[model samples]
Target: MVSFQQESDGDPASKPWYELGSAKHQGTEVTMARILQEQYPSHSLVLAHDVLYTTYTRFSILSMPGVEVELVSKPDLVVNNSFKALPRSAFVGTPGGDNVSAELVPSVEYGGFKLTWKDRHFLLYIVHFARGLSTNTQFFLLHDGPEEPSHQLLLAAGSYQNELHDEIWQFVDGFWQKSSGLWKDIQSANWDDIILESDFKAAVKKDVYGFFESRDMYKRFKIPWRRGIIMHGPPGNGKTISVKAIMKDCSVMGYTPLYVKTFKNFRGDEYAIQAIFDKARDTAPSVIVLEDLDSHITEQNRSYFLNQIDGIGGNNGILVLGTTNHFERLDPALSTRPSRFDRKFLFDDPDRPSRRLYVKYWQDQLAGSEDISFPEALAEEIADSTGKFSFAYLKEVFVSSLVSLLKEREEGHDVSFARCVREEIATLRKQLDKPQGPEVARNSQLAMVH
Candidate 1:
């Protein structure tokens, strides 16, 4: 059995030597494997290493059933020469709520721990080395048993991570990470709450639902079972909410939603695009939401993005739903191409009736509030006064009005909520009359060019 010794002395000569610095020059796995073999001569070593952000192997092992992990108190060998710990933050209550708490994850940077699984002893070392600008984490397992058990342990840990529940896979920083808060945010996004024209709403639903349900239909027609839909218009006109509703619906239909926040990462946009679609293909029959599609698909990565959309690797059962506020900025290959983004839905500024419906939706929300008297008729008045306003601007008006009303109450002065809302609307309307910014000017130029 491997016996424990005193912790590493300050002297570099006395301390154990590891090829950590040379990891950048050589294969990290090979270096770690060599170190493990030298340190644990009696036992066989199994090594698993990946970029720190890509996997949850440690957490998966911790949460595994009948598995116990104990940190090695006294280690004869300490590679990287220092002990480190960092806190893992978590929301205590509701996600995005005020309550946040963090727990110290011991020895995450570099430490040794013993894992007990199935009444067998296995020594494990969790170490991280800086690889260029990123950190590469290595998991070294030493056991006397046949390699199959250790291999099974690693495989089970990975499989546990792939089985996600109440989580949405998000592509950020060139990796696909899981975000439960995003899933929670979309839970309340139902189709009934979305205020679009009846026919328009139905069409959007059919576009998404029909594609997922008609996999066999696509096969019958001898076409690829992949689809792309673009939602484009001015900012904050039901585009985001509609996408969320679709995400929720897709989850209900047993399809995963993979949200891509941006394509800009350390490796470059090309790498990000490849990683995003790779995950989408792996989790086939999934929804890939490219929010702000115009910003993500630029001249640099346009061809790569198009190829991935209708690429040789056959994106079967994958649906790409892209949203953009600046439709004019999108390339013709993306906006007009047939198989790339097959359909484009314009979420233009709400018409008079749609605006009225939105106001009524807000009115109903405030009906039970004693402080805000948002009567049914007030909805019509506000909608009539707010012309050429996006849903976002209207929301700001309502929010600012309510805040002002609260301030008035706090100051021992009473004011009518209706008057406050009307004043705020007038204020926003004046702001809207101001000249457009340079970005808008550029978009207009591009629109003319297109």
Candidate 2:
């Protein structure tokens, strides 16, 4: 029988069970290991416990090949018949409209089940121990054969998790989680939707496409195959949209896109950095998107981040694409370093031609709408008048003007859509004259795109 060994000088069996206060019991309760031994005397037990920085889950382990797991009809004597219900929300997009659906997923919180692998039967119990403020989950596998084979089985289960093709892996809260919603959200982002200089757009695409396609070229030259590119510019430019378009294309090209939301977690930032690179190495030929890279890297973690990017362990076949609104905030080691972030693309304010193209994009959108009139010549006029305005501000001018026009139409007042747009642009230009802080600017940018 497997037992929980106490580190201190105390009898483990004499200790009270953590959940004893939940019920009224006269006698002292025994451990689950003792109960398992008394209930199944013929089976040998193998215990797998969670360690620091490592965790094992039933779904992840059971997802291994040739392992068939089924819920037992009857609950074990030691474990209770309780299940945890978690709420899951999903967006269903269709041709008609978008609908959000919510459902509860009932999972076994404390349960025992049977599994068959290679014609051998085994009993498994999932146990959760409440320690002060946190919970630790452990697995108990009972089999008839020797302990070595059972240990090997557990090792195999812990070593591998099925690769996800339909979902993108995101590192958040110190864990690599599957984000199917992000993958779905990027599907609509295409290169054609981006408004930028033709040569600049082609350069961005060629750099990304060339790195992934030229592995043999790097081998012949005897150079490292990894590359890092940074997109730096003012807020509300095309940095984010460009990144999304590239991510969508990379997904189509069969390279996994791993997005890092943050590097701060319960564990130190250094640990998070290590875990991030480890996952990236495991999924080589992958693209890592670090949006707001300036905020993610600080003086404390800059050295460690650089080491991981071009460290001795080698970052082969991994492309690191980072975006930042404030390029000056980045350290020289990161921005100026050759191998760390080899190339930098400046996404400054859109030129007159790009702004005109953006206005034309809106014209095409409103071509079918009879309520709004956006003529061909107004595109050039709007672009000319909207000087020094970021894409976010331009978008706000359009959206706010449309809203004002709708209100005027509802009040039985005839208003010209083009005049409303020109007035809104003038009003926004006044706001731009006043000195704005970073937080205010960030909020304005987020409102336009998100």
Whole-model lDDT per candidate: 0.77, 0.74
- Best candidate, lDDT: 1
Cα error, residue 420 of model 1, in Å, equals 1.3
lDDT of 1 by residue, 190-236 (tens): 88888777778888889899999998989999999999898888887
Off by over 4 Å in 1: 1-42, 51-60, 63-65, 74-107, 131-134, 370-372, 434-450
lDDT, candidate 2, residue 220? Answer: 97
Task: Report the CA-based lDDT of candidate 1 relative to the real structure.
Answer: 0.77
Candidate of highest TM-score: 1
lDDT of candidate 1 at residue 421, scale 0 to 100 = 92
Residue-wise lDDT of candidate 2 within 1-450, one digit each (tens)? 333222253322112333542555532213566666665677788877655343325234556788887754342324435343323453555587855354333334455666777677777766565554565666778786667767777877766543564677888878777777788888888888777777778888898999999999999999999999999888887888888888888888887788999998888899888988887788888899999999999889988888899855778989999999998898888888778888888887666676887888788878899888787778778988887788888889889998999999999999999999989998998988834323222211112110
- Per-candidate clashes come to 0, 0
RMSD per candidate (Å) reads 6.5, 8.5
